[model samples]
Target: MDDMKKLLEEIEKLKKEIEELKGEKEKKEFMESEKIIEVIDKIEEIVKKGFSVIEGAVIGSLEGIKRSLQEKENGR
Candidate 1:
């Protein structure tokens, strides 16, 4: 569970990084965007595997997992 928590945090960080990249105006910086895309894919793979390990049920998208996390946070 702790590992999954870290993976969730990484996903959030990746989201912020992608947003930040979008705000950049330099064309040179845009070239680095592909690297971030690769990172996002890798993190997503890890998250999917983590979810499979943590939950035996049908774990769909990251959005669904996020909602589950949010529900847990709200004491559902």
Candidate 2:
């Protein structure tokens, strides 16, 4: 009966340790996920700004070319 009691105590201690480790793992995973989401949001913002700049440049270039062509035709 003494031996059985000792074994039960050991098992309970192990179960508590396992629970603590599981909680730590969950916290770590949540932090990593939050970091990933932050990075993704930043990347999306940068991409949107880059695309807007590119579109503006293209439109300005096209307008300049059209104006030049018109001036040349008028001269001819």
Candidate 3:
């Protein structure tokens, strides 16, 4: 969970970097723009993986809780 949180934080940092680069883009060269695009792609990949992991974790926890509740109801 903590790792997933860190990955999300990294995505935020990447977004900020892109924004900063855009502000200075007119003064920069074409290669810099290409680099920004590459970073954006990489960030997209990381965000996808991070969200999937977090989603799986949350679903699994919910299932566990549901099972526990069912078992208690059965016991009663």
Q: Which stretches of candidate 3 lie over 4 Å from their true place?
A: 1-28
Please list the residue runs of candidate 1 whose C-alpha ends up more than 4 Å from where it truly belongs after superposition. Answer: 1-27, 57-76
Report the lDDT tens digits of candidate 2 across residue range 4-76.
9999999999999999999999999999999999999999999999999999999999999999999999999
Candidate 3 residue lDDT tens string, 18-73: 99988778657677888999999999999999999999999999999999999999
lDDT of 1 by residue, 1-76 (tens): 9999999999999999998877775565776897899999999999999888867555546668899899999995
lDDT to native, each model: 0.85, 1.00, 0.95
- What is the Cα root-mean-square deviation between model 2 and the actual structure? 1.7
Q: Best by lDDT, which number?
A: 2
Lowest summed lDDT over 10 consecutive residues: which window, candidate 1? Answer: 54-63
Q: Against the hidden true structure, what lDDT does model 1 obtain? A: 0.85
How big is the positional error of residue 5 in model 2, measured in Å on the Cα after superposition?
1.7
What TM-score does candidate 1 reach?
A: 0.36
| Residue 56's lDDT in candidate 3 | 100
